[model samples]
Target: MPGERKAETMEEVDLLVCGAGAGGMTAALVAALEGLNVVLAEKTAQVGGTTSTSGGTTWVPGTHLSEQAGVPDKVEDARAFLESVVANRGGARLREAFLASGRAAIEELDRKTDVKFVAAAAHPDYLDGPGAAYGGRALGPVMFDGKLLGREDFDRVRPPRREFMGLGGMMVGRNELGALLSPFASLANLRSTLGIVGGYVLDRVSYKRGTRLLMGNALVARLLYSLRKAKVPVLFESGVRELMIEDGRVVGAVLEGPTGTRRIRARKGVVLATGGICWNRKIRERLFPAGTRDYALGPQTNTGDGADVAMAVGARFDDGGDSPALWMPCSSYTRPDGSLAVWPHIILDRAKPGLFAVDAKGKRFVNEANSYHDFAMGQIATGAIPAHLVCDAAFMRRYGMGMILPGAGNLAAMLKAGYVIEAKTLAELAGRLGCDAKVLAETVEAYNRSASTGVDEAFGRGSSVVNRFNGDAEAGGSNPCLGPVGAGPYYAMAVRPADLASSAGLAGDEFGRVLNEEGEPIAGLYACGNDLASIFRGTYPGPGTTIGPAMVFGWRVAKHAAGKLTDQPETVSGVMTDERTKNATL
Candidate 1:
């Protein structure tokens, strides 16, 4: 036993962060900035985790960026908004900690790290409630030049999902999407599209993927760049197998990687941010609702390693939330390479004009324009296990559905692949979907009546701000989310419930320290990102909710470890006053 232990290489650092996501990278970067020797371990060869593939919206309300964008917000307002919406599903203290530190976290990152964020001009809150802002609350990462990271580091950054990209590996943003989707719409659009495509073409000459990175790719690249700048050692393809305990305190961890097993001692603390339990089938079965499928949008490597090691100790899971996971309706099809590609139906076609979803019996179920989470919830509540998103041929050509691109000429290929069903008549479409022709025809007739009047009497399709914001205002007559599905042939794409990430995870204190079953902090054990229980308690309040809290708490964890934060209340670098520090322990 002694010889085996001796054979393992031992290393020491002030802080050891397990995970290479936004939260974990933030921890390592901050700790290193605070003059602490830090090491970051990523289970996979690539960094970024799911963040690289995400929209990279960080919802941190009441920041300087908001004021700069002329959409000023207040922390108190955000608190009131959360209190009204979130209620008592999660700890009030944790929410307060996030609220108090969010501005400071973003400000600190902007001032010290390569990470930069620009507030969205018009991104609305997913839910309408007291103290919610129209915009400025959500910030998107500034574009990053992937070439600046060099070929080796650039290659280390995880690529965005194939479904979200263009060409082979070009990352596209929402701003350029309109131009690229309709390049000849205007002179400006044509120029913009050309510039974007030209940039990608130039990028391909020297890079494996697009050099001009946006959204999650930009966020991950900035964090990765900052970590490298701070000289933090990143252990790629290394995972924490067990947390080494010394007198009831987490002192180190035994990690397994490509080379061999190694032990790293953390003098201050260790932070867990290894995505979550979304891919852990055993835990997924236990926590998720019955009949939920085994599919997650996150990388498959997120198999609960962080929770497993923490739970192996005295740490307990936080199972108190509206749901165990964040939901997204996904559809899958095999790619030309013979690999399966799962496409998340998130805020693209569902809320657009000329589309509607129906249950197995051909009855309209939910407000198709509702948020993805609420849409999935509607499916579960109404027994619409495999809901069908129906649209006319005109809609398919204009908006597309699931993985089908707008105005795409590959309809025949998709139909042949069974990703989409096409038919010349509503009755024929119903036959393919296994629904009664009479019921299907009647449902369409009723929906058409509502579309003509621009009033969805059944589901209130475009009544909300978010609904209209995501809808095609130029296309729909009165209600942007309402349009006639009359033009034939008809098409259908079935979507099933899939989680973008896990909300239920290890319980932790406001300081991001992992809590034991007795409701006390486990010494030197901290968590952030999906590894920690969601502060909002499974509520999808707004854009970037997950990433916002993740970075804030990660900042808290690092500051606490570096001895810069304490139990005594104090001002935090001019970002928070004494009043704001009441709930947070400095």
Candidate 2:
């Protein structure tokens, strides 16, 4: 039932956005652009949520950037792919709404704000299922010059976690990867490397963080830049303690900030973009699989605040699939500063030849070149609580494991730190890993044979053209993804299934309206980003699946509030205990 939203006793804005990630910021921006009074609040002192620590890739299917990148994508093709991959866990309508609005979201941000993006030349859908594009669909925010944010603004922007950044604070994007990997490969590489290093050196002279913002950090900076242009004050250290509902309609929230507690009212509604429930221990223990760990390299502030608030006000949870969260294999070690250096094995290591995950039996159980999410899922299926990511001496020296960059970082220091386990032979490595030596040797031989050829008969490693996106082209042996770990010295790292993002979230309608357990909207409450139930349920479809929907639905929520709702599918996301059941999109 729609109740009177006017709250005379509280400070009010036309729109109140909670969580300042890409989604929340987008909603605020849209409202501000439309001349609506909007206020943004973040739980942490920082603006960006998990998005600041991510690659900021959004899985928007059709866009001008895709055309510019020369990848032809059709809505039907993407729809087909989603149907095959999502498998009805989240229903068809929600996916359709996402597909329809995704491109428009990017376009609006590009046209109305400083947010700009470019399609990856070769990103692929995680699953080699139907409607997958080799590229042109996944888009990353174009790198932003931190100087444009100015020193004060740069200082305000949250820095990427130290372990995620290079040179302590410098951010490197896709454009700089090749140069950083092989500085002597070309004059361009040399020059680019020098430029980055020089800039970092100068930046360290005054700024506490690197001025070169890239990837997700860059994306957040861009959004913040736009917000600054709009003159929106994003209140930090302000966490929502409770949602105030009158006659079943969410009308306001009691916020706890540094100064004091205040009830803030929203005329339009509140946008919840709190990045997932990755760090919620109680939820993870109760709902997720046994032995599931929080080795997340994402924002630790994700305590399910948004979901909790909404659920307290009647929103339902969606955690009824084979898995309850998006998976990532993470490696972590404590730093001398008492902070943990956690590394998410999303990319930069896995697909780069000579790496394989093995169980205590020392046998390979999965395709080495598969996406991190799928690889982690496969690990969980095998019940391998601690899988070993093994590689040879040459491979380790050439391509380092998590938090241990190749051809750089102190390798011996890392080994001594137990960040990596080292041995002179497979037998010794197997002994260290408590796996059978003979079986490990045979597994290596079988894998090496496949590496000698271009085919992995056992698992078809690198069979998909998309696998090469995270692989190395310089060493395109029989397969660029395959390399014999037949060398004398070996290295291994213990990896576990880490929660990357939550697939289960609060249910919502097409207008970003929060839905109750009975499948009806809770008027004046909306959710975007990881706060809302994932459209694909627990399956990770492609790069930026999290951010893409977040931005689009955030846009949808704002438009709906502003009376500017356009062509949007009527149905949205909600609880579905069974994937086979239709109307999975509530």
Candidate 3:
């Protein structure tokens, strides 16, 4: 509604960003740091969206983080990895743009904002198939303190404190988890725990500090503090309901807020970074029918608001493929609020041993220990509808099965709900699952033989720590695959392949400009993060692959809006017509 109505009492800015997730915040920060007038809006009362709830890793190859950690990498190496994964499906030009711009964007944020990067030495590129880097490409943000943001700033923006499954906060990295688990390990762990407890007691006696906290909350707290110090205007509890078009360009947006609806006119353009449609049940069912009901890890605000708003303004979308939403098994316990809780660690632990996940037909498909993204895709590719994670008694006892403890009742409940099943024999378990008893028996026997010898002959189960971390660590035999469930009372859990989020949406160029049906840019509108088809297409190249591309595109979109991309030739033509543009605003 640009020309139809008079521009009365309009608030103008160089950039109006939708969503406050990693992409949105990165866009806002970059634009603001470039000395542009920027305003960021979030649907939830928080600045960090899924990023706050994520592992906070961004896969950036040949960056300072990797270099500092002495990891061998270059821009070419990163580009090669992208090419190998995306193959011909993702355009080489777009991949090149992402690779070329990634480091600069990251370095800019590090130099100008409170955002700091640390190298994740252990994270690897997703494809071990070919041309994959060994390590030191992924980067995670340094931990920050929420208290540093002060009460006022903290109150204005909500951190993802209530999003964790049963834990109550975001997921922390290995260092943080190690610290928590260390206290339960040995003398060192005991000493560390005592030290923390002693410190708490002393602080309590002196009335100097409150309760101690750890993990994801601490990391988000730090990021929020930095945002506050940067003076970024994060309009929390404000959702972008519509886009404002002017002369075939995305000039502004209509924001729905707690106070009222307000029109934000962007002098430059609007950046749609509101994340993907992970929480929208209709969209989830349409895209991933089998796992829709079980996929529950994403942010509630990630309902494709940015995508919907953009589509309303004549933007086109692309579903990369019929890729299923990534899935992880969750606890069957119903909370007082009737929400399903997921235990990610349990899936990680159980799949590490000789246990193998099978489809309804009781057949093995993927490497059980692969990243959640690969496993999810494998399930879809293998035609697995409601896959099952089958393990022997030794596997269950070794990994403690489902949730750590105090929540073991949840597993029992799941077993009773037909969400999980247990039987003394393979044939009995197959009967319960309605699969051929002989097929399942053979599958288990083969898997057990492989496990006993420490080799996963069928699916390469012993590939990554991610897989081995959940497997039977003590299984004997050369292959380590044949850990026989002859111990009786074998277990099987009905695992609905779930996702952290859906990866399909409006397709965009490297600059984050939404493209039309003809593969031409739709001016005035830009999209990034989950709102756009993932840069890696459907395959997750490595850890933080989602956030890394999101940040890169977010930065690129803002830069392009600021006319920084003038040096680069337009790879594609504009598809929006004058008539369509006028009609959209009207």
lDDT of residue 325 for candidate 1: 83
Best by TM-score: 1
Error of 1 at 174 (Å): 1.6
Q: Write the per-residue lDDT of candidate 1 for residues 1-586, one digit (tens) a residue.
A: 1111222337888999999999999988988988999999999999999898888999998888999888898888898899888986757778877888878888889999999999987999988889877899999999999989999999999999987889888888867887988899999999988898898999889887788889999999999999899899999999989888867888878889999988988899889999988788878878877557577888989898999999988898987498888888888888778988888888989998789899999999999898888899888788898999999988988878888888957788889898998899998999999999999999999988888999999999999889999998899389899888776899999898888877899999878999999998999899999999999898898889888988989898998898766764343442345543643333
Candidate 2 residue-wise lDDT, 1-586, digit = tens: 2223445545888889989988899999988998899999998888888888888888888877888878867766888888888775654656666766677777778788999998877888887777788888899888788888888878778888787677788887756776987899999999999999889989899888788888888899999999999998898889887887787778788788999887888888888888877787777788887668556655777788987888887787777365778878888777787887777788778898888889879998888678878888888888877788988878877888887777736788888788889899888998999989999999999988888887889988888866776778789686778887767788889888877677878877767788898988888898888888788877888888888888888887887788776343333343222321222122
Alpha carbon lDDT of each predicted model: 0.87, 0.80, 0.65
lDDT of 3 by residue, 1-586 (tens): 3223334435888888888777777777777766788888888876667676566678777777788778756766776667676776755565666776777877777777777778766666656645467667778777554446655554544444242322333233443344444466677767765665565555354332322333334434554555566677778788988787666677788888999888988877888888777776666667665545645677766777876777776667666554534344443444458766555532345455546787788888887677766776676666675677787766665544554332243456556554457888888989988999999988877876775666777777766544543344555444333355556687776555566655678878767888866777877778877787776666677777777877787787777777766444333332222331222112
Better candidate by lDDT, 2 or 3: 2
How would you order the candidates by TM-score, starting with the best? 1, 2, 3
- RMSD in Å for model 1: 3.1
Give me the candidate number with maximum lDDT.
Answer: 1
Model 1 vs. true fold: TM: 0.95
**Better candidate number, 1 or 3, judged by TM-score:** 1
| Residue 209 accuracy (lDDT) in model 1 | 73
Pairs that collide in candidate 1 are none
Local lDDT at 496 for model 2: 84
